[model samples]
Each structure stands twice: as C-alpha cells, then as structure tokens.
Target chain A: METDLGYWIIPLAIIGGAIRVSTPFLFVSLGEALTERSGRINLGLEGTLVFGAMSGYALAHLTGSPWLGVLAAALSGTLFGLVHGVICSLPKVNDIAVGIAMMILGMGLAFYFGKPFVQPVAPDLPAISFGWWSEIPQVRAALEVNVLFLIGAALAVLLWWMLRATRVGLTLRVVGDSTDAARAMGLQPAVIRTCATAVGGAFAGVGGAYLSLYYPGSWNEGISSGQGLMAVALVIFARWNPLACLGAALLFGGAGALGPVLQSVGVSEGYYLFFAAPYVLTLGVLIATSSPTQAMTGAPGELSITK
Target chain B: MPFTSLSRRGFLTGTVAAASASAVPQLGFAGSHSPLTIGFIYVGPKDDFGYNQAHAEGAAAVKAMEGVTVIEEENVAETIDVQKSMESMINFDDAKLLFPTSFGYFDPHVLETAPKHPEVRFQHAAGLWSEGMPTNVGSYFGYIGMGQYLNGITAGHATTTKRIGFVAAKPIPQVLLNINSFLLGARQVDPEITCQVIFTGEWSLAVKEAEATNALADAGCDVITCHVDGPKVVMETAAGRDCFVCGYHANQSPLAPEKYLTGAEWNWAGVYTNMVQTVLDGGTIDNFVRGGLADGFIKMSPLGPAVSDAARAQFEATKAQIMAGEFSAIKGPLKDNTGNAIAAEGEGFAEDDIALESMDYLVEGVIGSTS
Candidate 1:
C-alpha cells in the first residue's frame, strides 16, 4: 500500500483497462469501417457480434480449441453478412430495414441454438505477458494482455495501410465515393459492397469471439450487453478510419473504466456517475465532430447515415 | 416448419379461450378438480446458466408432475409484453396459476393483470405485497446469504492474500446483505480480511464484469466472488487470472472445477414443487414466504478441490449449525462500513429478519463504501 507513485496507479489501471476492454470495439469498428468504405452499411453487426459470441463459445467448448472457435465465429459472421448483403442488394430494398431484419434473425438464431453452450466453459485464448516489465504484481496482472488484442491492433494498422495502398482498396474507395463513376470504370457496386460487408461481418465475429472466449469467457443471453451496438457509434466517432478506430475504442474503454478506477483509489462518492462516463464521452465526441455546417470529411459519399 | 402447427394451435386456442372464459368461476370453486395448466415467465434466456436458468429448472421440475400442464416462455421483459403474455396464458392456454419471475414484473405487469384475472393465482418472485397489492398474489424469495456466508469460509481460508473481492450488479439490500455476510464469514477465520466490492450499476454486463474481475485480481484479491445476475464473467475472468472463484445463483463449480471454492445456489426445484403441490391439493398460496438453508430454499454447492480440508470442515460445521437452527449469519454486534451499529452485541437478528431485507449499509471489514 506504500508507494512513491501513490495516486498514479489510477491512470495506469485505466490504461490497462482500456487495453483489456477495447478489443471487441476495435474489431467491430474496424470491420464497420471496412464495410462503410465500400458504400454499404450493416447495422446488423450487433446481431452478428452476439451470434459470433455464441458460435465461438459453443465451438470452443466442442472442439476444445479456442482457435477453431474463432474460425467458426468468423464463418457464422460471414454468413450473416452475406445474407444481409444479398438482401440489401435487391432493387428498392432499404439497407437499414434489411439490416434490422438481419439483426433479429441473427439474434434469434443464436439464442435458439445457443441453449446448451451456456453452462460449459470454452477454452480460453492464450495470454502473453506484456506485464513482465512491472515489478508490482498488481501492475503485472493489469498489463497481462490478451493475444487477440494485439492482433486487433495490428489489423487496424494493416487495414489503414491497405485502404490507401492496395488495388482492392482503390476499387472500394471508388465505389464508395461515386456509384456512377464506379460503373463507368467497370466496377460492380453491389459486389464490392457485399464483399466489404462480408469482411466486416467476419471481423465482428472475431470481436465476439474475444467476448466469449477471452474476456468474460462465457456464453449467455446477456453477455454482449450492447457492446456491439456501441461499436457502431464508435465507428462513427472514429470517422470511418481504421487507425482512428483503435484510438477511439481505447478511449471508450478508458471512459468505461473511469468509475471503477476512481473507486479503486478510494473515491467511491461519485462512482455511480462514473458508469455514464463512456456514454458521456461518446456524446461529447459526437457533438464536437458532427455539425450541420460541416460535412463528414472522411465519410463515404454514399454512406447511408451522412446522406 | 411452424406455420401449419401455428394455425392449428390458433384454432384450438380460440376454442379454449371461449370455454375458459365461461368456466373461470367454476374452476376456482371448492369442488372443481379439472386438470390445470400453469405458466412460468422468465426475464432472460431459459438456459442463461444463472438466475433465469434456476427458475426454468424449477419450472421443469413442475413439468414432471401428473394432471398438470406446464407452459413456459423466456426472454420476456417486464414491460407491456408481459401483460399480453399473461392474458394469453389465461385465455389461450387456460392457465390458472402464473409465475412472472422477475423483480421488475411485480409492479405494473403482474399487478395490472392480477385484477382482471381474479380467479387465477399469481406467484411472483421478489414480490412486495403491501396492503394495496392484490391478495391473490403471493411473494416468495430465498435467503441465499447463508450460503454466501458458508462459501466465504472456504474463500476466507483459501485466500493467500487477506484481500477478497466481490463484483456485484447493484447495491440493493439483497446484494448488500450477502456481501456483508460474506465478509463476516471471511473475518471469522482471518479478522483482518478486507473485501473489495465494485458495483457495475447494471445486472448483466459481461465487459464490465471482466474488467472488474481483472481490476479486483490486480488489486490483490486472490479469492473473488460476485452477486450479479450471472457469475459467468467473474468465474471465467478470475479463473483466467489463476484466482480462486466463489460462485453465485446456481452451482457454478462446473465452470471452473479447479478454481471454484464453493457456490451459493438457489434450490428452487424443491421450493417450486412444494408450492405447486399445495395448489394441486386445494390449498391456497396467498402469503409471503421466506425460507433459509433448513427449508431448502438456499443451498451450497459441494466444496471444490481448492478449499483446504480444515476450511471445508469449518464450512460444513457452520452449515450444520445453520441447518440445526442454532446459527444466523445476519447477527448483530456488527458495525456498518461507516462505523454505525447495525446490530448491538447479544441483539442478534435472524436470517429472515425484516431489518436484513432493508440493509442499506456495508458491514465492517468491507473495503468500499456503500454509495
């Protein structure tokens, strides 16, 4: 309890918390950023996320391998994304409504099929000790990072790099910026969008795998607790940039940790208010960034929300 | 697959509705012995492996009885949707007894529907039956703190560090009471044991629960427990950290057999059977009931491998004393976290004491403030 760095542990804990809690946010928003970059919006990722969690946990329990569980989750997520993509590609179909329908379908399927997997313990994802740098056991435990977190961070950077540098990325950008131009250049907007959504859905599935196999490491009806939907808003706050998604997710995680952090330091007087820190910070971000007078500079021109 | 059966069931239900409306009065009469249908509503997935699962298991037990039909629904929120579901149970299924098993369902949904179906019986979980509430409604709850108190003994001895941790959903009296008992039990072995508690402000947030679990473990709590809707997050997170876990709601030892010390579980199967059997035997159930360990309302899971033999024996002795009616976990001679007297010395309160129901203070030895 004695320390020269007495109160600084709060910030350290928050940083550790941010890293621990933000993997799902990072993955889902990165996925969303990818999908939105090709002029399609998949609001159904929430359903995809929960379904992925269910699939991942169940498969992990059955296969006794956490890696296989992640694969199954991604596959199921891709299936959800494919269905959403195909349905929304139809003439006169509203992508938002289709997304909503997909959400319901995905959740219903997950809950109906996920019954037996609820009580079983899925194999845990391996952890790497980044915390060895600290001598304090508490600090070491706090900093003991999950392997999936590092993968998500690396994916974020790779995704940001690919969006600007790759051929496929250029095609996606052209499709997102202008449909008429994309068609003139021999690009199929629907095809590119569907592929983008499928990719997005796959990433979401991995995020959910992180939920059920790594962090909470259990499958239940209430497991997701709106983390998937929160990622949608987080994507918006990140301005559809994959690299920014990482920072935004960590920020959100830090905000989520604020209440618990304060209480840990013996400041419990306003802990209840700290529960709202994430939403409050999110609202603050949205207000500061979003204005009627200003266009979303990074937004895809055909993106549904900004349009 | 369901469309054809759905229409056929709709026709059957329509006819049953007509027959039931006319037979409602006669069905409740003294000589009536018509076969009965009962309904159970849940606030979460039926197989949530936690609170709702416990209720569903009890309902399943009721399903095995002869001359009774059990109809159950899951994931039904305590909103207007519950009113409609209750109406369907009465009209379509001809269900005479209904159990809307959620704390939030008591006020508006159950109360509003209770007046319209006076001939039916309503058994609500977490019901507060004041003078104004319906007389046909009965409230039932278990004192699970005794089990927590027992579980804490194993945790108390199992802890290499004097610091223990609890990840709770909210600071409700029921939850606060359990935390106090847990600490008191821990202090029984090691008086210097300090419990760190963090409330997530919501019932079932897995992310927050994981983060809280890690935070508690990092803060040096070797033995961690929880009083959330589900202890899945706490159990898995703690086990992941190589920390010993004490579970809640149902027996969660199965989740982490090696790491689990013991669990506080609700034995609703026996309780539900007893309640329904009374109704089947032409007895009324319109009373508030609270049962302790002896009554089989609250039970403890078997001690896990992590617990030492001495701790297990100590826990069993305390359990035996409770079952023999010689011990009460909520006894006085206690002080709140703010150093206020909760129970004066020699002024012990029983486990079922009403004062324990409204417990708003943290007991001494708890590290965090109640607020």
Candidate 2:
C-alpha cells in the first residue's frame, strides 16, 4: 500500500489540508478586506480571533451546541470590533494605535477567561463528507469539508458582489475615499466606518469559531500561530478584494501544510526547513506582487497603510 | 501622566528597599529557625497540563512540606524576564533556593544571576551544568524515556492497525531518546509494528500539533502520542477522532478517559520533596542529578481502561525489569532507520550512560529522521 500510494499522497494531502487550514484565514482576511475597504485597519483582529475562539469553545461546552458557540464567537467579535471602532472614532485617536491596544486587550481577556475551558471538550462542528465514494480512508478524511468553510467561501463572493454593485458599497467607498465628499453627501464617515468595522469583526469571529470548533478543534493559549495577524498581510496580498482573499488563504494553507505532508511521505530530510514554507510563501508573494513605482492597485484611498 | 511619574518613583524606592532586604536572608538564615524559602518560576501557565504543570505539581508538593515556604511565578518568559524574576525572588521574596525550571533559563539567565547571589542555590531543569559554571548552579533531569517505553507497550497492545504515531516538538537528543524507546517498546510486542513520527518544530504550537495529530489519524495510526510542552491539543484532537492516545510529561487520562491507554509522567513531586527535605536538614544537593524509574524520578501513569489485561501484565513485568535494572530499552542488535549500526550484538547502554545522552539517530522501524 505504501509503494502504490506514494505517488499521489503528497498532492492529495496538500489539497485536503488547504481546504481544512484555510477556513480561519478565509474568514479573517474577508473581514479584514471589508474593514480596509472602508479605510480602517483592525490589527486587533488577532486578539479578536483568539477571544472569539475562547468564547465560542466555552459557550459550546456549556450549551452543547457548536452552532451556538459559533454565534457567541461572532457576537463577541462584533463587540470587539465595536469597541475598536468606537475608540478609533474618538477625536485625536489613532486607529493603528487603538488597534494595537485592542489586540493586547483581546488576548489578555481571552487568556484570563480561557483558563478553565482549556481541559473541557466542546462539541465539534460537523463536516460534510464529499469523498464518501472513495474507499481510501485518507481521501475520505481529507474530503470532510466543514460547513464554515462553505459559508466563508459564499461570504467572499457575496462581499465581492456587494462591494461592486450596491448603494451601501458606494457610500462606504465615498466615505473611505474622501471625508469631504462623504460629508458633502450628508453622511457621517465615523458612523459608516464604525459599522463596516463591526461587520468585519463579525467575520473574524466566525473565523475564530472555525479554529476552536472545527479543523484543529480545541482551545488553548497557543491555538493560533499568528494566523489572526497574518490576515492583514493576506488582505493586502489579495489586493483588498474578497474573492482574491479566498484564493490567497487557500495558497497560504497549502504552504503551511507542506512540511507535515512531506514528513508523512518519509521525506524527513530538512524537515524543519519545510516548516518555513508558509512564511517563505508569504514573503515571496508580497515581493513579487508589490511595486515601488505606484500606489497599490486596489488600496483604499484613505487607508492608513497606503497613505 | 501624574500617576505614571508617581508609580515610577515608588518603583525606584521599592527596588532600593528590596536590595537592602535581600542581605537578611543570606546572613545565617540557613541554620536559623526561619522557614526555608524556595522560589519556582515557570515559562508558561501553571496548569498547562504538560512541562510547566509537571514542575508546578512538584512545587505544590514542596509547598505542603513543614517549615518550607514556596514562592512561584508563572508565565515568566525565558528572556531577561527570567533574570528579573530570579532577582525578584531573591531580593523581594527572600528565597534562598530558586528553581528556574525552563531549559532556556539556564545559559545566560541563571548563569549570569547565580554569581551575583552566591548564597542562593539556583537549580535548573534539563540543563547540563558543566565545570567552570557557578558553583551555586546545579541541574537535574529524569530518564523519562523509560516511561515512554512503557507507554509504547500499552499503545502497542492496544493498537489494531499495527501502526503508532509520535508527535514531537523537535529533533533534540532528549526527545529522540523518547521516540526511539517508544518504538523499541512497541517492537517488543510486534516486530511488524512501524512507528511514524512527525516533528512540529515547536514546543507549544497548538495548531501544528492538531494538524499533525489529524494527519497521523488519517494515515491509519490508531494509537497516537506526543512529546510537546502541552499535550492537551493532541490528546483532545486524537480522542475526537476516535484514536487511542498515550500521554507524555503529565497524566492526560482525565482529558480522554475512554481512549487513553497509559502515559509517561515525571514524578517531580518526590524529587522536589526530597531536595527540600535535604536542604532543611542542612545538607546540599548534588551539582548534577539524574534518575529513572528505579530512583523514583520518573513514573508511568496508572493504566487506563483501554489497556487490556494481557497488555497490562506485560507492561507491569517490563516495568519491574526496568526498575530492577535488568532491562535496557537501547539494547544491542539495533540499527538506525538508515541501516547503519547503532549497537552490535550483546551490547547496550545503561539509562544513565552519558553515551545515551548524545543520541542522534532514530532506531529501525521508526519512520523519521533526526535532521
């Protein structure tokens, strides 16, 4: 069986892993993209993601429903987003500074409250078996896609469409592109940006739910290996587009899985080096896509990173 | 801004007071009637269910002793923060004996701090205390690989797939020893059994650990175990996937009661209590200390419900042999996975042999590379 299966296992495992690992990335980047589309950067999504994971897991363990856990995670994320937005909206408050503070606060809250939930087992989110016809157990396991991944994918498409062809999208763009124009249109830029950031936080919360409810499927202080923070980079690589964010997340997931997939195939030489695949991929993609000649292709006009 | 300035002045005054207070403990406190104060610092939370928890349990045992006061600082980093913690313990808490339990606390933190406080005995865990180091500094480690071997015996008997998985943090010698021993112990049960090992390249990465556990389960490894800082993620993930698990570092049966077979645990409670008692009796601990199952330094967790009667019988018998020094996990007639000779026929290294400490190769039937 080892000899016969050796040829295709690597690619098969990578594909399966890409689907499983990308859920959190997809959710966070989508949320980040939405926030950045309104000219705000929420770096605290890392803390938000972690806090959501803890709250979701704790709630799920107590309530006996993974779906409710997911809801609680999203709500907690929204609360975090609202807090970040409200604080950033205050006069003389720097969004980036507020974001950094929020990140620390979110993680601190999660770790403090998350101590008791570490040992208890919570109900896991169910997955749809797409490879039921396959007799190979690995194939079946790999094809078991979680429901959240599908929701994230659909959300990406819906978001992309909403950003392109809707009145609310146009208003957000106006508020993000030019504060004067937004006020000229009788719109409150703070109110619009705050709402957008809150929705983005909701997306990030669902992403956190993905971590503690599915995939790795547990809660701990180390559950996230900077994936929450990585979403910001991922959003930039995706050119602030929701659809592109989906593809970029899958790419990151595939790179992250490279080390373990190689080890499973008996390629243990330079094993530690393979673990650097995701970071290398990130650097390589950023360097290749970035230009020194002009503004980023789709950066929001008032975005702090671009300005 | 006003509050910040006030607090900064208060901190400076406190530091001066603490510096002066530190001298009291060093002045004839050893032979005096005062309680011996011992300080323990952990690199992570006290209840991490892994490496730090093992030490914390030991500290708890020492805390319960008569005429002994334990001062513990959890979540202390391995950087300058550890040095600061050591200083705080000595200067502010008046601790005469300090146990900086993290491995990274040894090199610069403990070494640099030990000299400044000659009266304080700084003992580190899992560090090699060579000559030329401060006389006040000592090191202690356990032959926990023996416990892993027993875990392997339980896992081997429980596994129906004839395959087992090991999730390791790194390819260090100490970790390698445990992996090899686990494989060898399983091979004793069934020669055809092959152990697949996956190195996550980190001590406490929950995401990678979970992914590795899932990959192992997907590859048909019915029994899974791991050597990481915290086995909570691996144990829970494996149990969720219906895979039997053997734990490492601490008892994890409570996490997966039904699926848990057995576990390799560090009996630091006994080691800590003994060291504390010796100090209280006006004695000094050895500069370098090491012990295995026979010396009560490491132990195996009680066999879980999943362990069959036959498996438990073999496990107990082999454990008895190990304790009596009649059995060696790294015995002769062994080869590396690369087919190179590790030990020829009728040759073996005892558990405490310095040769075993430098182990760099995985044994045959273990599917992994050290590099």
Candidate 3:
C-alpha cells in the first residue's frame, strides 16, 4: 500500500498512463490530422475502431500472434474506410451521415464476429521498460510500459515533420484549404481525400488494436469506452496537429488516472466527477481555443464541422 | 455357451418377439401422446460465455435427455423479432416447452406470445410469471447471493488490502443482488472490508471490464470479482498483480489459472433435464419452479488450483451448511450503506420475503450508490 513517489512510481504512472491512453488517440488523431489536411472529415472512425478491434483480435487468435491482430485490424479498418469513402464520393450523400452509417455497420459486424472471441487468452504486446537503471521496484513497475505508446509518439513526431516538410503534406494542405485551389494546382481532390480517409481509418483501427492486444490482452464487446469518439474530439482539441495530439492524448490520460490516483491516496467521494474529467477538460479547451464568429476561422476552410 | 445358442428358426422367432416386446411399451406410450419438443430463444449469440451461453447449455442438456427434442434459435433480439421467432417455433417446430431467456423478452412480446400458445409451457428466466397463474407460463431464477457470499469469503480471506472490487454490467436487480451479497459476505470475514463497485452499464463488454479492472487495481483494490458475462478481463489483468478474482456464469479458471479463486455457476443441466422430462411425461405444468443448491440447480464452480486446501474445505463446509439450512448466507446484523440495520442480529431473511425480489440498497461495506 505504500507508494514511494520519489522512487519514480508517480512519474512512471503519469508517463505510463499518458502512453497507454494516448496510443489510441495518437493513431486516431494523427489519421484524422492527415485526413483533415486533405480536406475531408471521416467521423466513421468510431465504427472503424470497433470493427478493427474485432477483426484484429479474431485474426490474432486464429493466427496466434498479437502483431497479426494489428495487421488485420489495419486491413479491416482500411477496407471499411475505403467502402465509406467510395459511398461518400457519391454526388449528394453527406460524408458525416455515411460516417454514421459506417459506424453502425462496423459495430454490428464487430459484435457479430466477436462472438467466438469472448473467452480467449490472446497474446499481449511486450512492454519496454525505460527505467531499468532505477534500483527501486516501484520505478521498475512504473517504467514497465507498452511499446506501442512509444511507437505512437514517434509516429506523431514523424507525422509533424512530414506535414511541415513533405510534398505530400503540401498537397494535402492545399486540398484541405480549397478544392478549387487543389484543382488549380492540377491535384485531384477526390483521390487525395479518399486515400486520406482510408489511412485515417487505419490509424483508428490500430488504436483499437492497442486496446485489445496491449492494455487488455483479449477482445470483448466492452473493449472500448468511447475512445474512438473521444479521439475524434481530441483531433479538434489538437487543431489537426500530430504533436499537439500527443500532448492532448497524454493530458486525457492524466485526467483518466485522476480517480484512481485519488482513490489510492484514500480520497473516494468524487470519483464520478473524476471519471468525467477528461471529457470536461477536452470540451473546455475546445471552447477556449475556438472562435464562434468566423465560420472557418481556426479550422481548415473546407472542413465539414467547422464550416 | 451351447445352451445359449438357438436354432435358426427359433432365433428368428425369438428376435422378432424381443423386438415386438420392446415396441409394445413405446406403442402404448405413443398411443396417447405426442413427442415432447422444447425450444430455447437466446437474447445474445449463444457463444456469449455468460447468460446466453448458460441458457443454451441448459437447452443442450435437455436435448441429450431421452424423448426430449430441443430446438434453439440464438441471437433472438428482444423485439417484434421475438414474437415472430416464437411463432415459428410453436407452429413449425411444435415446441410444447419454450424458454425465452432474457429479461428484455419478459414484457409485451412474451405476454402476447404466451397466451396464444395455451397448450405450450413457457419457462422464463428472472420474471415472476407462472403456468398455473396463467395456463402455461413459469419463471425461475437462482439465489445467486448464495454463490456470491461464498465468493466473498474466498476474496475476503485472500485479499491483503481488504478492498475488493466488483465490475458489474448494470445496476439491474440481479447485478445489485450479487453486489450486496458479495459485500455482505466479505463483511462477515472482516467488518472493515470495503467493496468498490463500478458499473459499465452494458452487458459483457470486455474492454470496459478490463478498463474497470485497471481502474480498480489502480484504486488499490487487491481482489476483484465481477457480475459480468466473462471473467477474462478481470482474471488476466489481475494475475501477478497480487490480486485475486472470481469468475461469473461459467468456469473461467483456464483464462487466468493462478488468479482465479472460485466462481458462482448456475448448473442448468438439472433444470433443463427436469423441465424437459416433465413435458415428455405430459405432466400438468407447474406454475413456477425455483432451483438452487438444494435442487442442485445453482452451484459454485470448482475452486482453482491456486486456492489453498483450507479455503476449498471451508467453502465446501459453507456449501453444506447452506444446503442443510444451518446457514443463511444473508442472515443479519445486516445494515444498509447508510448504517441503517435492515435485518436484526440472528434473524435470517425470510425465504418468501421481498429482500431478494426488490434488492435496491448497497450493503454496509459497499462504497457506491445503488442508483
């Protein structure tokens, strides 16, 4: 019951929780970041997430490796996104509505396929301990973290650099800013948006895989608690920046750890409020950062929700 | 050997006579009756290792019995779909005994369906309807508190922190009953033992279950139990974290071998077999039948190998005491979460009382709102 905070346990818990909670948000937000940069919003990532989780877990269980689960999740998510993109490419169908329908279909399929995966003991992802030098067991325990968190962080940084320096990023930004501008530059807006949506969906699917294979080493209907949707909200909070998404995700993680940390220290009265902290903080930040005056003031001009 | 041997003509005649003799009893039985057919409808997929699976397993047991034909329709969502499904089973399958096994199916759909099939017997789970009360409807549920109490003892004795957690799907009466029983049972071992309850409000979500477990673990709860469908999340995550856990609905020890203590299991085979046989015999349908440890309907699964022999023996003794009426697991000195004494000392809960029926309060050691 005694936690030596100075021994790096608290620091590790903060850092570890940040990584654990942020991985899903990182993938989801980064994917959204890319998609938004390409002038499209795929709200269907929630469905993609649940479906990818089911596909990944089922495939992994069948194939006997967690990495296979991730691959399967990505492939399934990409396919789902592709279907959504294709359907939304129609002349009159609203992309948001298609996204909603896809979410329902994805969840239904996930639950349908997830029936056989109820009681499985799937392989878990290996954790890489960054605090091996610490002699204290507490530090070691805190430092023991999932490797995906690091991957997500590194991916975020790489994404940030790509957006700033890469030609693809420039094309995506142009496509996002104005379809006319993209057309003027001889770029096909539809093709870029479709690819962006699919890739974003793949990231959401990976986030779901992180849930099933790393933090929780099994699949069930309860594997996600609105994390897919939360990640969508997080994208807006991060303002479509990959690096800011990482910080935002870790903040959500810290907020998530509050109830437990307080309860650990014998505080128990306001646990429900603590449970709602991340959502509240995200909403607060959104309102604080965004202006209501201009339709597309802070957001990319062609973005759906902002415009 | 020579004496046993018969001539070819005599052997042929004897074989014919033996076959006739066997056929006569069946002929007499069949002359006055139709073959018994039972049907089962599950709310979720039959593979959902919790409630639906338990119901399906019961149906399977009935199917194995002689003269009983069992047909099942899984994934029967509780809607107009149920009415249609029931109609198909009744008209096409000729099912005389039907079990619509989900709480959601108990309302207007069943109410409408049960009366239309007057000749058929309907045995429902969790509702308080019965055939004699209304021609051919019956209700049955286990006193799961019995098993929960036993689990509490194991958790209470096993836990180093005296803080146990329960990851419940919803705050439904059934789940609430288990939580209350678990807390009461833990309190019996140590009055100071506190139970933190987390409700995901959805049935059988493993992601939420694991998240809830991690939350509880982070909150310093060293032993966890769940009223959820599957125990994999709680069992797997708690292993080597020095946390003890118990399964629900089925034996999940194989999922987390060393971490499992014991679980409350509903042994549906006996209930299934008995109900099916009653239909086969063309007996007058009983209004309702409650099956529990005494009837061998409800039982605690085998303790995992990790449990000490002493804990196992203690559990067995407790079971025996409960069976013998020498123990009332929910007997009082019971107090509500508000410190109000609900049951006086040495005064056990009356079997017919409303405590189990309208269970809506947290036990003394519970640290959450029942609402």
In terms of DockQ, the best-performing candidate is: 1
Task: Rank candidates, TM-score, best first.
Answer: 2, 1, 3
User: What CAPRI grade goes to candidate 1?
Assistant: medium
User: Residue-wise lDDT of candidate 2 within A26-115, one digit each (tens)?
Assistant: 999999898888889999999999999999999999999999999999999999999998988898888898898998999999999999
DockQ value for model 2: 0.44
Q: Which ten residues in a row have the lowest lDDT in candidate 2 chain B?
A: B23-32
Which stretches of candidate 3 lie above 4 Å from their native place?
A1-18, A87-94, A130-143, A251-278, A304-307, B1-45, B63-98, B104-122, B129-136, B184-192, B350-354
Best by lDDT: 2
Task: Give the per-residue lDDT of model 1 (tens digit) for B83-138.
Answer: 77887888677799999988789888888878877999999987767677888888
Q: If you assessed candidate 3 against the hidden native complex, which CAPRI class would it receive?
A: incorrect
* Model 2 spans with C-alpha error above 4 angstroms: A1-4, B1-34
Model 1 stretches astray by more than 4 angstroms: A1-6, A290-292, B1-34
TM of each candidate vs. truth: 0.93, 0.93, 0.83
Preferred candidate (lDDT higher): 1 or 3: 1
Give Cα distance to truth, residue A147, candidate 1, Å.
2.8
DockQ of each: 0.51, 0.44, 0.19
By lDDT rank, best first, the candidates go 2, 1, 3
Say which prediction, candidate 1 or candidate 2, comes out ahead on TM-score.
2
What candidate 2 keeps of the native contacts, as a fraction, is 0.47
